[model samples]
Target: MPLIVFCGIPGSGKTTRALQIKEYLEQKHKCQVVHLNEEILQMEKKEVYKDFQAEKFARGFLRSNVEKNIAGNTVVILDSLNYIKGYRYELFCLARAAQTQHCVIYCECDPQLAKENNSKNANNFTEEMLADYNNRLEIPIPKNRWDSPLFHLRSKEETPFEEIANVLLYQAKKSKDPVSTAPEIKFEINFLQELDLRVQSVIDELVQKQQESIQSNVITFSDCTEKLMINKQISLIELKKIKQEYLKITKHNPPKRIEDIKNFFIIYLQKVVERF
Candidate 1:
């Protein structure tokens, strides 16, 4: 796993830089990046991390995602305001558990400039959020015990996008290992049954609403539901709870028609069960 955690205050250009790094990794190295914040918000159907408690849930979600991506060769970039020290430590533990290489890219920018930029952006946080985050945020200090290299970037004068991108590309090249040779298998009956139930539950909830696709073959509800399945490490009971919610909301299952989704679930379950 290749995990890059960004640490900075609100509006410190963390997201911007993370996206840039993601693009660079994808285009140059042919690596796929799983972004945490965008994936989680759309998946949960609600903002689960508005406060500190929610943040912990989000961190737990990230840990699982990093672990999942470790099996693949792609680099996962965690783009968020990792301002809390404890949260940073939790991320370190996650990387270690996954046995993946990790790095920290500190998006250092002038506070006033970040505030100005945030004020001008559409989804930017308001004054209250900036104040709360700034006041309570504990900055990270570089260390070696974590076994990951940390790069501190002071933005305004030196927006380290290109330089950092180069560094990340170099790291990716040096760390290249042979591609995974695991055998592929078809999904079994039991596995598809479970996935079918879960998808049916989500479709039941999303039936009435018009949802838009954020990426190809990847709708918002799909992303969210997949995250719940992939990241939360949810148990069978929790999945049953989702189905219960669907039953409570719709009082019936949503009719399934598309051959593609049907085929996907069938194949998806096969792959998952085989991996197990």
Candidate 2:
């Protein structure tokens, strides 16, 4: 449950450091590392970096992948120019919600040298783009909880593999041990029961609405076909199982708002229904 984020300019050796960390974690710790660099490279091959919207889409895609991967006991390394503080905050929220540990590695580099390095690379950014990115970069501060445990490294500095490994591995072990003040499992029984009821209620309402639409002859044949597909895919037992799985997932990271809870139930139901 370790998320290592790399933050730096394009030519700041962020990728190199990420690779070094990935190698060390895999070799020394025998840990699986999900490198976002490969994903970014795939996106680059698709030219997803050409447009701002595409870049945002790529980030969201990568974030979802990270979220899914972090559900298990693997290490995630996000190798990118994580320049936006808000984006980093979003990542922090994801890590917190998933009960994972995360830290940022900032690769500090001189502008002139960075530009010179960029000039030597084939996939180099234009001087104008690099300047724009630099202007837009929001450096992570230690005062922010999300940016705590921040590790700083100069462009030419050797990667401190052992130090980082110890911090992540040992801290993860400490966190895994249950806290003395942890709430009693029985205390959450009532909340889980209520959540289960709410999930069932939402599914019941959706089925009723679909039946009403079909009986009222308001839906076309194609719509009926789609409804039938969903109905055939989501059996009552399967729906109940899905609800149970959702409850288990949310037990640790429950939705905070009433609307969010309802929305979560509906969205999860839709996802499960669509899978078939």
Best by lDDT: 2
Error of 2 at 62 (Å): 1.7
Encode model 2's per-residue lDDT on 34-111: one tens digit a residue: 888634546652355555657667667777888888878799898887776656766776786666688889999998
TM-score of 1: 0.54
Every model's TM-score: 0.54, 0.63
Top model number, TM-score: 2
Q: Which 10 consecutive positions of candidate 2 have the poorest summed lDDT?
A: 219-228
Per-residue lDDT for 221 in model 1? 50
Query: Tens digit of lDDT per residue, candidate 1, span 98-167?
Result: 4456778777767788899778766666677777778777666674333247788877545455555554
| Clash-forming residue pairs, model 2 | none
Worst 10 residues of 1 by lDDT: 225-234
Off by over 4 Å in 2: 38-41, 45-47, 177-276
